[model samples]
Target: MSDTKILTLIEAVTAALDHEMGLDKEIVLMGEDVGKNGGVFRATDGLQQKYGDERVMDTPLAEAMIAGLSVGMAAQGMKPVPEIQFMGFVFPAFNQIATAAARMRNRTRGRLTMPITFRMPYGGGIHAPEHHSESTEALFAHIPGLRVLIPSNPTRAYGLLLASLRSPDPILFLEPKRVYRMVKHEVEMNGVALPLDKCFVDREGDDITLISWGAMMHETLLAADQLAKDGVSVEVIDVATVAPMDMETIFTSVRKTGRCVVVQEAPRAGGLGSEIAAEIAEHELMSLIAPIGRVAGYDTIMPYAKMEMQYMPSVERVVEEAQKVLKYV
Candidate 1:
């Protein structure tokens, strides 16, 4: 038998935390229900039993306090990994994240660093309630001193979580909860960390480029397969790190394919898709054979459970948009 085990994204998270916590004595994990409860998704399951309460602490149900404590703990040379139960619950702590944790390194002229990893589950699906289904990564990505990372699969989840823990700066690690157990991968328990601020080319093609990250990657890859069956070659790119994006990879792919469609689960206006489209237009406009396309969530608020599917950009919408881009004269 191989020295690898099949693990879901959430299980990958737990494994990464367990492995890293065992290695680094300075690394402490704290958040509401993270100790005895092991997080709402059980991403930290059994860690408290392994490391005890002092290391795997359960904080009060206050987001701001959690963020503040992470900033302070990290400043004192401890690697603090804090969790905000859900993405929507983070706004109350945005000030702490944007002002303190993110800017601490630059603010202190590199004398002090906030080696903190803030974890939260984002995106819509699973029929979650109002605040539980927000995909506002753009909010954190826009901050000047923060790094925003979203992993699309179990391997990336394991690698990225390890990378974030080792980073000397603040990182917002967004987990796609919808696909927490949607698929599994055989992952070796190696301590290797994937490079940060890079794009992963999931599929290489010569026709159109399909770009997306987080849970939207699931639909984007499905659309790529569907398009391939129709004899349309699609190059798929996962923008793992939304902030400080590896635009050169995208530019190279678009220059080769000459057509591109960006899929984002966020709202259509003022989202990262618009940013990518604008950047491509600015840098690689003459190389384009057609106007860049985008398939994203509606501009209105993400609705309740029943209408969630209607609001999300489905595989059909992505294929339709890709076809339109390909057929454009």
Candidate 2:
């Protein structure tokens, strides 16, 4: 509802954190460098100054300690937002997240709830060191009792963060490090928080539907624009929440376009795209006019800064897949 301006995705994330901390006294932020350094990406910039060190305390460089402390804090009636720095480093705390935080409510029979939010910058594109850029959303999504929300744009990033903080269950909030400062869009806090299970249709067309999320949304949009210039219409859908996908939107788009091409930065084998492709095949087989295609990263560890682009999905790759699916009709 306001004029659009250039704003970094990290700014959106910081704004959401500040807003939530101010709105809820029980909400607190903790992680390495989150206090003084304001996080590696500066996503928590100035929070320690605003909320004081007690609430925004900086912890040891131990992922497991961060996760365990957050779980205990959440169980004690406080909402703790823990930053994992990078997705690659999150493996150290996988057991705490999977066994303790995620299963707390069920284990306690509703007597205890772990309302902790795990924030991690993920996906390749920034040309960072090897472990710094990884798409681990699918790994977290595979775990039950945890909500996974990955936002592509500024508005959704802000809204989804607010929504995740207020959620009753543990949330895995993955931000695309590549687009953290690339695209800009005006964001208003007046908008309602988006549900965790919903998907968004960025563009509508009759030719083919491009399903994607996280950083890949930007490339998907570029592909759609290129196809538009070539006299081909394309629809773009953002699966903002990978765990509980918006099946209604996905099914409707496939039914209308009759073709789908899922794009993701994760590896092709057993990736989120594979699950989506399977769901579409099982439910919308009759509605689809062509076999669903997937454009994803190769099945290998992300490479160094120079070869990072080769490990993730690119605009040209998405465009080629769209063309292949479009030709099926």
Candidate 3:
């Protein structure tokens, strides 16, 4: 295992895909521009040269066809990884994902399995044109028979992509687009299975529990650091996996701090934060010292590049919510 530094999240994802393709002959990559163009964000960069065009195929710009074909391929005992260039464009294939791809095992009465990974870059703040920035993980999480995994850092992204390739069920892997070229970290190539349902406590504190996932995690961490300067100890929890959430870790932190703030880049209404808040309210009501608060994107459609900062959650917003929750106790 070499300790190589991954300079960007896109590179980390590409490396993970490359590693998996090298180790397993059954694994094949399919998507628009994946073969020669290496995908829109280059997440599959150089894979075509390494694995050949048959293994790294570039398909038409039809998401439904891409998803349905991948399902068919997986049913035939091949592991297919399909990439949706952007999360907003994923709706074209939602029916296949929620029905055909996701329900294969149950529909077959356990006779067959569709083990496919749907990877898409999600979230805003990258200043891209409209339809290019979106956080739609909540949509997939609501669908049954599907596992949803969101990684906040390069190491987790690399590990989770490998594990998703090995999962027997279909997986919706959401990569934060805003951070795709922002951060850097060292990653190990060991095929370790990081628990998908557990949240990592990035910082331990007794004052408040700041819960966030994906790109928002970076803002939460920054807010925690800024809060620490003001003598406010903040507990940061990274919800790596959205579905089958690790309520154990979340409730534990809420019970300890008695204050919680959930943050996300998606719209506040009907988003993952709503479900998380509901869970806490239902199970840990008595332990709460304040009303569970959330910092999220506005309800309107995503704005243009100039107004993205206001459409998405910012560090200032996180700190404001933290301060509000801190006052409740």
- Residue pairs in clash, model 3: 123-134
**What residue runs in model 2 are displaced by over 4 Å at the alpha carbon?**
1-6
Cα TM-score per model: 0.98, 0.97, 0.97
Q: Could you tell me which residue pairs clash in candidate 2?
A: none
Q: Local error of candidate 1 at 171, Å?
A: 0.3
**Alpha-carbon local distance difference test for all models:** 0.94, 0.90, 0.89
Q: Write one digit per residue (lDDT tens) for candidate 1, span 53-161.
A: 9999999789999999998898889999998999989988999999999898898899899999999999999998887887899888899889999999999999999
What TM-score would you give candidate 1 relative to the actual structure? 0.98
Ranking by TM-score: 1, 3, 2
Question: What's each prediction's clash count?
Answer: 0, 0, 1
By TM-score, the best candidate is 1
Pairs with steric clashes in candidate 1: none
Q: Tell me the spans in candidate 1 whose CA falls farther than 4 Å from its real position.
A: none
RMSD of 2: 1.5
Tens-place lDDT per residue, model 3, 52-74, is 99999999889999999998999
